[model samples]
Target: MKRAAALTAAVATATVPLLALASPAMAQQPAKTAAVQTQVLDWLSLDALSGTALAQRVKELLGKGYVPSALNVTNATNPQYTSLWVKDTVGKVNVLQGLSATDLPKQIDQQVKSGFQPKLITGTGTGPSAVFAAVFEKTTQLAKSQLSMSKETFAKVNAEFTAAGYSIASLDVYGTVEKPLYAAVWVAGAATGAVQVTLGQTVEERGKELLAKTKQGLQPVLMAVEPGKLYTTVWSKGSATGLKEYLNLSKLTYTLKSAEMKALGYSPKILSAEDGVIASVWSKK
Candidate 1:
């Protein structure tokens, strides 16, 4: 996943205590679902600090294990002061302020040496000074079930669905396991709403079973799918990273530049003309 962008404030300095403000309304709102909670706060009053000192203080905060994953600094209200939003681990956020370069700690230099570079940092001439940061933690591994797939027999099974009047919207295949294989496809039938077909074990057997099941369970409700809404294919040897993995399978090579291709750990030129190419990047693994 890409790193979150940072927010920046433009004020030079202002007299505001970090702990003097009321808790933000978001802090009071009840948690919903299982998503990460984020909050904004006032970290320091930078009314009297110099630019160098401000930088130092930022270094100090980072050194204490507060490396921001996203950092936003702005100066809209006070010309000198800036507000900051710092998101740390789950349920932890710090809003602080800095007075000057002197007020900044010395740990910032170390952060730059590390990979925690800010995505955006700009200065404006109005509003409350603010900075937003997204702290980094260990990358969470998606569950195995979330990434497993089979490739060998998916084409045949999907073909059966198409023959039964179901439009296959998306076909995803992965080369996991052997013998039975594993595969998944998203299909839209006239009557079955949107359904996902997952095949596990014995590719040929599962494919036959899936064909029979679709005829028995899905064909009765298959609706006429809309035309012109082209379905794009994507393939990747790497683990699925959302829609990006499919880019290679669809052969969208022209859309991928050197930098983007490198970032995805893929080579843009390693594609075939007969293979599916959308926009200019290789869409197949």
Candidate 2:
């Protein structure tokens, strides 16, 4: 079960260029730090777990052990799957989980077009930091049943999105023991621009090529891998504004535990600690 616990962590604050555009809200007396690490732990825990009770599984993992620092994605892709990744001294693991706030499929497009209410979580953590949007949470779908596809299959999948009126922003295909069988795509809003593979490196001489690609104004938010598989997500400016943002996990704390850091000395700028997860950014005291 632990072998399935693949996850990812932010590439560190300096890696993302958009943090330069911190809204005035973050520039107050004490700047806010994004909750990056928290998300990583959650993503890892979900993969290490199995069964039907999503909440219980999460609870069990939290109690076992994890750091609370960063983001959480809501209404990601289809509720049939939610992405969570973690990394550490051992290795990197990314998970595609069939999870939801409620027991129905997530229609993310409709939610965005209508009204999107974020699911708020609370609990314990390392320190206190402001709540932030999960770095990148796109609509991702993993096959319900194992399936395989050819290079033509990629073309057909792209066509399906085009016909539906959405564009393919970024996608990574997965395979079983031999052929490419499953994939998850990050859908784009505009069909006009191009998602270019500007940066790339061969993962293996003949096996695969992992690259950093970008389109619109979005950046590659997360890159995760599990043995022979990989998953990546890219994003664009949601609002007309050109600014892009990503969470940086500054603190981590666990449930049934008291804050280990000096909570009183530092002034809190951002805070979101609930349901066994803790995220916060504090001002220099």
Model 2, 137-251: lDDT tens digits are 2123211111123446655665565566555432333322133332234343444444322111222311222112222443332221211322223333322132222122222
Give the Å shift of residue 217 in candidate 2.
Answer: 7.5
Query: What shift in Å separates residue 27 of candidate 2 from its native position after superposition?
Result: 31
As a TM-score, model 1 comes out at 0.20
* Model 1: number of backbone collisions: 93
Give the Å shift of residue 225 in candidate 1.
44
Task: Provide the TM-score for each candidate, comma-separated.
Answer: 0.20, 0.31
Q: State residue 56's C-alpha deviation in candidate 1, in Å.
A: 3.3
Predicted model with the maximum TM-score: 2
Candidate 1: tens digits of C-alpha lDDT, residues 86-195: 32323222223332222112212322344222122222221122221222222221111111222434556555655666454322221212221222223334323444
Off by over 4 Å in 2: 1-47, 52-148, 169-172, 185-188, 196-218, 221-285
